[model samples]
Target chain A: MHSSESSEVEVKDVKNAGMPRRELLRYFFAPKAIAVIGASATPGKIGYQILYNLKRRFKGDLFPVNPKQEEILELKCYPSIVDIPEEVDLAVISIPAKFVPEQVRLCGEKGVKAVIVIASGFGETGEEGKKLEEEMLRYALYYNLRIIGPNCHGIYNPRTGVDTPFIPERRMAKPEPGNLVLVSQSGAFLGALGDWVSQERIGVSNLIGIGNKVDVDETDLIDWFKDEEETGIIALYLESVKRGKEFIRVCRETSKKKPIIIFKAGRTESGARAATSHTGSIAGVDAIYDAAFKQSGVIRAESLEHMFDVIRAFQRQPLPKGDRVAIVSNGGGFGVVCADAIELNGLKVARFTEETYEYLRNRFPPHYGITNPIDLTGDGDKDDFKDAMEAVLKDENVDAVILGIIWQGVVLEDEVVEVLAKVVKKYDKPVLGSSPGGEFSSMMSEKFNRLGIPHYPIPERAIKALSAMVSYVRRREEFFRDEE
Target chain B: MSRILTEYEASKLLSEYRIPMIGGSLVNSVEEVARTASAIGYPVVMKVMSPDILHKSDAGCVKVGISDEKEAERAYEELLENARRYKADAKIQGILIQKMAEKGTETIIGVVKDEQFGHVLMFGLGGIFVEVLRDVSFRVTPINRRDALEMINEVKASKILYGARGRSASDVNSIVETLLKLSELVEEHPEIVELDINPFVVYEEGKGGIGLDALIRIE
Candidate 1:
């Protein structure tokens, strides 16, 4: 036993020397072969649904382990992980609480590098469950295996098609492959967010649910995704942070490279109690968390919807060079509303350059408001929007533009989407659209999204999203400048 | 779970960190009070030093504007009597005699140990700004110089420190230095769970500031 222990230590040292700690998570994200420990033949079971989801997307080898079944999902089933012939890089465990630790030990003996436990009733239930979690953790530590959770909904990666969320694809639509990565401490939130992302057509790089974070946690994910070439934004919905100092350190370093937006729940006293029962986490004072986020350059979203809005803005548009924004609207009221929101959200209504003012005055009649909002009047058309956007975008004083499109106007047609999209592509500054109305406006918003412009149902949300981007840029600059 | 140090002990600890304070010495008797007051120069302030009496002013154990030895002696006895009246069995340390700090913009700086994030530093303007409005800013400790500056500038009443309404600008750079020093002090001494330097009077720019009163809690 002593000789084997010494050899294990030596192997661990060699592994550590060969790769950084973050690289260990690669097996979970991009495994060559995977084994489902509790794969079931019956539909609607967690094991079955997880296997079905994996079967649809996972491109690697899949092995099913079920003692009761001869075959499942048209694949051969083994009695145990150790009995499998091929090497398994990852294992998804979905069995009763009593049997999970034994399976974890077996996977450890089988030399699996990573394991995702989908079983509940561990650490969150009672003393007995907590004891089971401890046992599993001991086995994982001895074998040097990385565990995602003792109770979690599992992970999904669009780039590699590694879907392990138990919610079936039909029930929860998987988003297309893109740069936004979503991580949630609550599995149900991820499930709902997945549907929302699909509905909104927000492309995602990965969706991870870290339940009862016994081993892998938000800090590990942030460190791993900070350097990931495919990930451009890291968004999280957290009830509580496990390692506070370490989380701050990793986020401070990562936010300088890319934006990290967090929607931390449990701000009020009643909410803290609910969060405690939900995840068995003590939500510390909310002000301290706010200070930590600010110090680390992490953007804190006010609500769940706000988080998605911020994510869409970061995902689709270039960051503004400054907080000065120019508004273009066909109606006067919408322009006025946007101007009020811009100042309230810590953004300035831009002061146009003389050239821009002269150019707009020459293009439009004297009755038109040709200053900051650049009101194109009720007769505004696609050509008018194109001219206004181009002139303001060309002005050195304007860092961004917010288009308040009242789609109900008679002259404003769907062709405005293509025209504005083409004009925005010519400039590097961010441009967001606000078109508030019924089905027609929603349809136009989707079209705008496809063309790389984030449209909001309300002008306030659009301004809020743009303000989040501006704050992120300001924080990034301040953080880097302090280092210098 | 924690022990609040007497004002004398708290002041000694602050001195170790080089935090600017209205210079004072602990006096054991009426004679010593007069000597310390005269040496530090009047008008001096005297307060009872006792852990049993947390709110010194509330207990009527604090006296200010002592311009002579006779007044210092009289105030010393009065403070001791007040301390005894407030808490008969209170453990008395000594009388703390500090030179009166010149008036400027009043500010507050403090540190509280959060269960999750450890020590967090807090800064705000004093008086109604903090008491009535609760306008303050916080940062996790071991902060950089830039964080210190931001904490000072983040408060709504920060304009008062910057010479708002025809007032001269206070020594903000001095407050930044004290905040950084306090950050280092707490970072090195994790057992110091809580500290407060209330009504830290700031003089005009380039003249510096001094902590007029302080309280320290340790676990």
Candidate 2:
């Protein structure tokens, strides 16, 4: 929706300063060329990892600059940015604390436009680091340079193959750039999900491991990514927002334009404490953030993994037209849990029509519950599953269906994927999963994806995603319409 | 302390801060109104001054655009009768008649201090629709010229100030200047709790705005 570059724009002394900056962000999706200053040959360093990711992921031009090395990762390393041959659009700086100021200065002199500072010990550290960051920011501002972080991890644009490292977890890294852009304030929370999303074949568009954002914050990123054509869904894991008013405004404004899923870590005191310790982010006033979210219509994820779960579903399935959800479960308890999660998320579990009910009763047991949570008594086969799912899908009142497959016996992934895929594609309604059995969880999710059904790992995620989809429609109608 | 300061007390504090106020007398009766009317000018407006009464117009205590002694006496008697009828216990301190302030366009300017965020000044088209439309902008106060302009620009009625839909442009520059000056005054004197200048008649083209009605609550 919006571009990363646009978020770091200088609200110049000129009144029209912000508009041009917005235009600049559009180039971030597929950066034509990049300049890497402070490109170190050191093994564990962020620069090395960043270079590795970019060269491997991005198919665009890459320029490496290191005063100490002649070559880095087989790419020619220039002494300074002033020597880079190609006119670079973006610069990634991962150097020692002392040298960052000079590198920033040199970046401006070379006319390299945007810079991401993957260095620590800035304003977050104390007065000295704060002064250093302020000086660097002053230089960036004077040069019209857009800066991402002074103390932060980096950003990843999967579509562009532009990966800059400010994130910590090194060995467990798996680069998968799908259509979903997950912007997180906590690096560890985001860094953990990397392997899972890729292994599951879930598409991710952008992953920003932002830490102590000095120049560019979440507001900037939301503004940049909100309107991105490549990004189908946006998922965020934030403990605190630097600009409360702007965050609410952007989320309210963007949620209408596209589906934005959020995982806020600060609901309870303990969770908020963990979030702060993990990311140097305060849980903020939970009530205020909650109110802000409610006002703006952002879908709040229950946990970090749950955030990804809902996102995975949104990425796979087309949004259900309305809030009416139909639940199909093998067990009564699972059906009830699904119902609770649905209503808790502010959506109603839609009832099946009499025709659809008869369609189900003919195929399943007479004692089966069939109002909203169509429970096929504990002992039900694949035929019972298919019939119940079809009955729910056929109902005009049910916009979407949640399949709570227990998989009591041995479940074949290939077989289920084919059947579920057919039903999902035929009806054009989103179908989700809540298979309590451990043996079938992975297989259920796998099939869910193959058939274009957005399945959640938990009932909560399914409810959250459905609620977000409905909110996206509502927001678009309320704020993002043709008229102001 | 939420102190209710009289008009005189407010003018005294504002005088030190260079806030301009209209010259008038606080009259007790029809005789005093006649005397004040003669001294002030032929045409004068008498409004009831009471701490309990915030909305004088609604209370029928605001007698605007008055002319001569007989009219002034009748307006004062009518206002006093209405004020006593409404609140029953509200003391009619006196009638404040400065002059019939030259009416023009209407604009509102005020500041609200939030517990967590601090003082944020607001500027918009004044009156009943203010809360409804919320055509306003805010900035952490003790504002400079840039902030003042931004605050004024925060409202959609800003286009109306620029003379939208064939309406003549109001004195927007003056509106911003008054808000900035007002913000600085209130920020400096924390003793002044709430200050309002509703429908601050933005005078004729190029003539600058005037505070048509001024109310002050002090601490």
Q: List TM-score (chain A only) for every prediction.
A: 0.93, 0.84
- Write model 2 residue lDDT over A299-376, tens digit each, in one string: 777676667666766787777788889988767888889889888887888977788877766766678787778877
Worst 10 residues of 1 chain A by lDDT: A274-283
Which one wins on TM-score?
A: 1
* Fnat of each candidate: 0.32, 0.00
CAPRI tier for the interface of model 2? incorrect
Query: lDDT of each prediction vs. the true structure?
Result: 0.86, 0.69
Off by over 4 Å in 1: A1-20, A270-284
- TM-score of decoy 1: 0.94
Best by lDDT: 1
Q: What does candidate 1's lDDT look like per residue over A418-481, in tens digits?
A: 9999999999999999889999999898899999999999999999999999999999898789
**What lDDT does model 2 reach?**
0.69
Per-residue lDDT for B120-205 in model 2, tens only? 45566765436566455555455556557655675677777777788788877787777777777867775654555555677555
